[model samples]
Target: ETLTIKTASKTYPLYIGKGIRFQIQSFIQALEREFSSVLIITDSIVEPLYLKEIESSLTDFSNVYSYVVPAGEEAKSFSVFYDILTFALEKELDRKALVIALGGGVVGDLAGFVAATYMRGIAFIQMPTTLLAHDSSVGGKVAINHPLGKNMIGAFYQPEAVVYDIEMLSTLPEEQWRSGFAEVIKHALIWDKPFYDWLQAEIHTLADLRDEKLQFALAKGITVKAEVVAEDEKESGIRSYLNFGHTLAHAIEAGLGYGKMSHGDAVAIGMLFAIRVSEEYYGIDLELQKFRKWFRQFHYPEIPKHLDAASLLQLMKKDKKAQSGTIRMVLMKQIGEVETVKVEDELILSILEKELEEVQQ
Candidate 1:
């Protein structure tokens, strides 16, 4: 199936299906761009497994090149970005060349950034292999991490198209399943209560994320993201709502060091915190224990015992959500209803301390 994401700059199609990678040549040909070269940017972990199939699919159409980066968040680095640029240059990739981001979120982000900056920008396609990339691939938010914060350096350059093949997810580790589902849950919580209820009632364990159900979840999540991005392409307003669990999530990733923890695990923890804070600060009605139980069953990580709430607050201040030294966050008044609010440091610290204490207990 296909969904169209309309942005201020341009519109692109997000294609989701089983084994769609095989049809990539036809898809690119339909774009009518006459790409001179196709650079497939993938990670080391995914290279040996899927590179041959993807490269073979494109070889008949254009000169195909592959650049493999280290797997995980570490790939979203300045050095790696520079290395990709060098590789593209050495191979003489020009404006007519197309970049194919052919792995998980890190590869997508790094490659998309490389494509966005190379030759002042070139067309790129997203062929996301992991479930987490379902969220990262759809948005035009390509970025690299800085020493100070996660996704601190980047651009709002959108992809030409996103071709997500669910078949690739079969090889993902159990941890990747847990990591990716958190975003699915996030989408449900912030936009569709019916979908949220469906998830809570139907999806009990990792085994439940099978073919039909998994497809439904991914399509719904992408639709939510597409609608939001269409409305606020640059995150000046409603787009901030997409960062519901991300403020604290980013802090946790940066605090623990990138790649040390999964992005979904951190966001799961952050979402739980956001839920608790919402109940306290807004008096929103929630079944906290029930939700907590669901999280535990799915193996979402609890807050680390040694992670200082004060330090995390300091890191949050550096988050992109912060404005003029005030930290802003997407807070829910209730399920399927949320708003961005300016949260004070003291209140944030108080809530973090409370949540951390509960985790310890």
Candidate 2:
């Protein structure tokens, strides 16, 4: 199915299906009718996987060149982003040039931001590979990480279209599966009760990464994300709920070093902590036992002993959601429901001591 998200500036389509990458030609043909060249922004890992496919698909259209940046979380670097724009400008890419992002979160964010800024905002298409991209790929949000915080600098630049093909995930390693699964967990926790139940009942090991179950999960995740983005394209309202695990998750990733943990893994721990804090501070019961039971099934890394309660709390308060010296987080009162709430620094520290203490244990 094709979902169209209308922002104030443009209407972007999201194509969700198996092997949809083959249809990328239609999107590029549409862009070609509107442009003169195609600039494919991909990372090292994704370039080898899908760049040629996109090249062949767009061969009938304008000329195409790819800028392959370092893959994984590191591609969101500002220096590398500058280099991409420099390369494009050196090529004398015009406003007619279309930027195609083919990869996971980092590639989407990096390439999307470049499209938003280059020539004061050009068009870009999203070809997402990882399961996690089901969420990041559809949303108009684009960004890069700052040394002090994750996603600190970003713009809400809607893509020309989000083309999601479930087949590309087969090329990913097991660790990438674990990373992507983290976001799937977040989707279920934030908006889908049946999905959460299904995930717990059917998905368990890295080996389960390939199957009908994964496709169902990805479709459900994209639906949830698309609905939220359509309602709050600028993140002023319900869209913030998508960050349920992200406030602390971003801090954890930053504190532990960006690449040490995948975005979803950091978020899994963050989701766990958000619930614990909600239970402690707001008396909101999300049935913590059931939640943790499913999350723990993933067998992800434990929060290191070196990451102390005080240190983690300090990092959390620096999160973008923090206001007036107090840390803010998205917490769930129950399955499929979430809200942004404020927590005192002392209370956060207390909750962290308890949660981190358990994670370390």
lDDT by candidate, in order shown: 0.88, 0.81
- The residue-by-residue lDDT of candidate 1 on 32-64, one tens digit each, is 778888899999999999999998887465588
Candidate 2: which stretches are off by over 4 Å? 30-32, 359-361
Q: Give the winner by lDDT.
A: 1
Q: Which ten residues in a row have the lowest lDDT in candidate 1?
A: 55-64
| Candidate 2 structure quality by residue, lDDT tens digits, 143-176 | 9988765677899898888888888888987777
Report the number of the highest-TM-score candidate. Answer: 1
TM-score (all chains, Cα) for each model: 0.95, 0.92
